[model samples]
Target: MNTNTACELKWGMLCAALIFLLLGACSDKDAIDTRPSYDPSKPVTISRFAPDSGGVNTQMIIYGSNFGSDTSQIKVYINGHLARLIGVNGTALYVLVPSKAGTGEVKVVIGNPAKEVVAAGPFKYIFLPSVSTLAGFTDKDGRTAIVDGPIEKAQFEEPYWLCFDEKKNIYVLEEFRGMRFIDADKTQVSTRFRTGNGLDRPRTLSFNTTYDTLYITNDQGSWTGLSTAVATKADNFTRWTSLIYSLQTNGGAAQPQTGDYFYNSYSNGAIFKWDRVAKVSKELFRIGDVSWEFNIQFAPSGDFAYIVVVNQHYILKANFNRETRQLETPVHFVGGRRSAGYQDGVGIDARFDQPHQGAFDENDNFYVCDIFNHCIRKITPEGVVSTFAGRPRTYGYADGALRDAQFDRPMGIIYDKESGTFYVADQKNRRIRIISTE
Candidate 1:
């Protein structure tokens, strides 16, 4: 062949060889080892684990070698249950302890090849004890004791009333402190709101769950909102004593909205419904010649409201017509005449001496703080009255069995459903007393 022809053939051959070499390089790269390999001599090993003991859903870290960074290829088991792997690195893995996992060995599996490694010691699953009853409260040593303070900073000076919101935060009415908010744990305290408007001597607070509004009654005879950001004010009462919100009506144009609230005037013995939207107060009904209304609470059924007649030493169960905004005749449910004594029986047979505040438990059982009698009393849904806490006629700061425990004029009382505990504002003791079976 001519020199030019030979040069062209050589160029084509060189191009073919170049293509073959490129194909080989691509194949080698595609076949590169992606699967992690384990050595029999230097197998996967777990050195230790941080926070080897924790409750369910708690995150823990595992320290080891040959864990491999691929999360999907790794599995972690706490006590036989597979733990959720949150992250994984070559030498460590993070996981959440599985719910219902018991205390046992923690195993880490590296890959489908199944190189398993276990820590030196087993991990522990912490299960919190369940509270069974509200019979009494005790300390770590199992001795009867008060759970909350007399700490100077958290002490209350005549805490008149208290109520819990949906979040379980407590709103307390301190005679001098205006309104204070205590967290569920009671570890932190905060002021719910502050306003230049007279909230002096706030006596009672009622929360409207539907509107998230708080209706407060003070000695100044004014109804105000907890937050100044909201417009809630109704003045001109002789003396506002107790406050509570009406239940929401499902049907009927004439029925009051869920935001409406009611308060009783101590001086006039009149109950007034305050329209939250219109910011107006209208008298609903008046108890004949009755004086010193202390506490008012609506039953969960929303059929009737129980009012404490402080001077009468009885609880009046008043039925209200949501459509007409009128209250029917009130009945003395728990006590009889104005005589003050310590006695437990059915309905009118029971006696109360200066009952202050009242609350209801999950079972609809009504509880009252019989201040003068120095005990907490419970009135069943069937109208059977009994002393639930505090020794009758016994007054001190001692804590023990209901019959042996002494309370110094316990006032504000509230029930916490979350903990199944009753928190009492032991007014004379200047401390909060809790009753529970935790």
Candidate 2:
């Protein structure tokens, strides 16, 4: 062969060798494992895992024997919550820590019939706080009904307002459906009262200092008519009487720990102190010429009151004079008056869209239901405003981690100090959503 011919032959041979190597590599990658399948009779065991502790979605590995190569057959659980199995080899199984998997033992189960093995050490599950549905249907189809029994089977037409009794039992005011009582254990919900009579168009509600009487706000659609009604546990909440009236339509009421009751005038922005003994009301303070449906919330210390100006899109902070039983001059605490939008900042820098109601934690941290914004707003004691949960401008029914959760026009929110949970009246969604630190 000539020089060029010899070069072509050598090139052809090198090309043939490269092709063979590529084919070999592909075959090695795609080849099925010929190793004998793991036998359940060998007994599954979890000797140890890397990192030992993790949060949701944290990848963990279990090293042991008889875990089987089939990912479907290998199940891992951290603190009783199932961990997602990513992949598995005979000796090690890879998994992602599941949400709400608190610190606890790590168990591994294998085989179809299932044999379990737990790690020698418990796994400390570090997870971010999440928002979950505590009550009502989670579907986004806008379900509205009044059914009460077990919590899982209970339903609400529209959870308009909520308050807790001394026993920690939750009293939820259903718009157009009257009142619902959720037992302290959260296992059952029952209709404490049916609508009609004086309990019409229930907008907000609260328990008296004794917790035996439930006061609810009812918008009478007139400037002067029945606005607040009450039902006592003595009567089993079967009937309600007009507690305070002739104020305005679409107002809210709050009973402070000091054993005093106050309601707002939705038309003129006046806070009235109701004297239950005399069955009368006296104007405590007025927020200038403002005219809108609003709600009131007292600080944990009772030294201040937050006025949620519904259509004005801002919150007013008023000094509470315990001796005089009145609120001092009102000033903007956060958000802009009549300036509606979604923004988070300090004081006036933050914005809210049609803020409706708020609740306070033990630390005086205020949480407001920013209705039109479709989210909950947290106003720190320092006046720092931030989105606590739910995506602003996004509306739907979702219950999961906070970042993925959504709400449609939440109308009310109440914080339970015992559980550090905030129950939300997801108005348009027609369900109650909760945010709790897990």
Candidate 3:
């Protein structure tokens, strides 16, 4: 063993050691995160519910983390009531919230089979509840709604439409004027956002379920004429003020301008969109005369819209394209020239004449207001129509009894799942009627 041999051996050993250390640092284990970590403290947003039109079965959006691709292991507990996860994508969930009141806390529990790398903690769902109903259903003292109290007498009219925004404020639309917001307390209406200036009779409205857009259709106005038209007052988005959007001010058309509008009925043939926020509108479809667009409803997904052409005739689903900015042809869904009457219950094509508004069951089955037939008609998503209530023969107002069911022109409709009550806007009867369907 010479000195030269010993030195060579030492250098060789040092170089080999250095190579080994470098290889260890570049190992695959260091590059790949095979196990997932669940940090409950980091705060995973499990679910979020927005303010609604104060109806039952309000929809909600949910997000979850540490949840594997298999969704069976994740269970959402809203107020202790288990909600059915409509769709599960990765850790995100789209759920229909159980009506609040049982419990105030929202709990997200990872199933036993949940493969976790870290401990998971539940996040409290600070749900913003919505209150729409007044104390009673009576027009007490002609000032307060039966459910909501203390509404000014001036606010009462042919019944202004009530809607809600993403922020939860209610919007009230009047025919001649414009739209305004009603606070959650149901006490005061903010005229700050009024979109009426040259509008004739702002009546019906449809709020895009997924966005900040709104469609307002005025039934009629004195501004309408042969040529020299007048435009209705819309929320002055350009000026961010309450000024009316009349051409007289901008020198475009006339006071009440009619560009994409058509010759339709007063409350029947309705302008499809006419959004207040977008500051533009297009003709959705046309109907014969008054009581048209009676029982209109949007697609559950809000991708399309439907209208029950009453008095004039025809039932069609209006398709719209935001990109092309045109309302394509309308698909005739239901309605006949003989179609008449829009009262209570689900109004069917064969059995329904003048159908008003409609309500949906958990299955998305539309319950139409078969006004003329004096009964309710059920129409499935496939367009299959049937009878659910409001039989013209042997119909009377009985407690949960199928017989003796009488509805005098049932108009507007909303279902209250909590109390099993079906609220009806009995227009001709000049009162809102309630029948428990649950």
Candidate 4:
């Protein structure tokens, strides 16, 4: 009885000890962390972010610590909106703020455990006024809202093209009065100069900020009664008749001295660049076979130039080589289809009748005056075209919503990058019309 009892007791004790050991091992393994734990003491830190205030899609750099080498583990948020992560290192991260992100705190999260670090100061999401549509001249009545001209006198009678300087000063070209200048605040007006020397009609004006020069394109004949004569006399009458005048911010000699200038001949549809210093003129390109080219404009980026073919009722973009000052073959960017109706669509699907001039806004959106349609159309960078202002073929002197506002014939337009405003030459209305955000 004693031997049997002793053996059973020993085996029971051994089995019990084995069970206890097994449970202990399991508890230890459960307590051990397979993944590295974030240290509370060495918490993730975000020191700062560069360009703290920026608009949507702005690239931003964040400086921090413990952000891990793998960018895939890093997630950034600006004002609670997920930002597009571009790159990251252990100490810094590159990200693009989400479009339309509001002003709020910037947060950076790292690791599978998801440790988050917030910036010291809130990141400001700058909001620019979205100008998808036009609101007519911010005045009581459209007809009497000439900021520069006399209340009774139509100082802009036959205003053709207009532009704004960096300081927001305006320069307008008039068929009868030539060039007029208006101050930034619109309180002062000055008649700077007039076109002469057989250039009876000034059609367009271009400002080259790089060279600080003003280029004028003039037609040799009048549009009043010499349409047939202009067609026949074309090249001979308008050849080398354009002017290039040097511009001064202050009141200097703003005269056209006939130096080497670049001009467009509407009669023959030829574009020539003249070097007044060299006394030589070289023909760049011609669209005489297609239609008469009316206006030529260099992109604000200086990467391309757009030419408006009035008779063809379309616009063409020519790739310009800045270093060589040469233009490549032109490509149709907008309004190739010849429908005189007011419709907005994508690229060639949109129709423009007699697109007289074109201008580029801050975001590179191209705006054109659809002369016959009597409206301004905007073409996006992605080739989407839409009517931005004025009613289709509707003429009146009212001021309000762009669709409700009437323009007799808008021939020219220029955008103000600083204020996000557009000054339009309401040709038949005989006044300068303004398009601005509400």
lDDT of 4 by residue, 62-122 (tens): 8777665556777899988899876655566777777667789999887766888789888
Query: lDDT: which candidate is best?
Result: 2
Better candidate number, 1 or 4, judged by TM-score = 1
- Per-residue lDDT, model 1, residue 49, is 79
- Deviation from native of the Cα of residue 342 in model 4, angstroms: 2.9
Clashing pairs in 4: 259-276, 260-275, 260-276
Error of 1 at 434 (Å): 0.7
Q: Candidate 2 — which residues are off by over 4 angstroms?
A: 1-125, 138-141, 252-255
In each prediction, how many residue pairs overlap at the backbone (N, C-alpha, C within less than 3 A)? 0, 0, 52, 3
- The collision pairs in model 2 are none
Per-residue lDDT tens digits for candidate 3, residues 1-438, read 999997687556544544543343343755773334344445444433322122234444444554433346666666576765554444444455554424344456665533223113322333332212321222544433222234442232333344444454545443344544456544554453334343445545444334233445444333342211222225321112222232111011100111222223344354434344664544555544444444345544433455665554445665545465444566767555554543232223454566655766666677666665656666776677766665563333332343345655554555544445455544333333445454
Residues 3-52 of candidate 1 have per-residue lDDT tens digits of: 99976875565445445333432335557734333344577988987676
* Candidate 4 global CA lDDT score: 0.62
- The CA lDDT of each predicted structure is 0.64, 0.77, 0.45, 0.62
lDDT of 1 at 328: 63
TM-score of 1: 0.59
Which has the greatest TM-score? 2
Query: What tens digits encode model 2's per-residue C-alpha lDDT throughout 308-338?
Result: 8888788888877778767777888888878
Error of 3 at 131 (Å): 20
TM-score of 4: 0.57
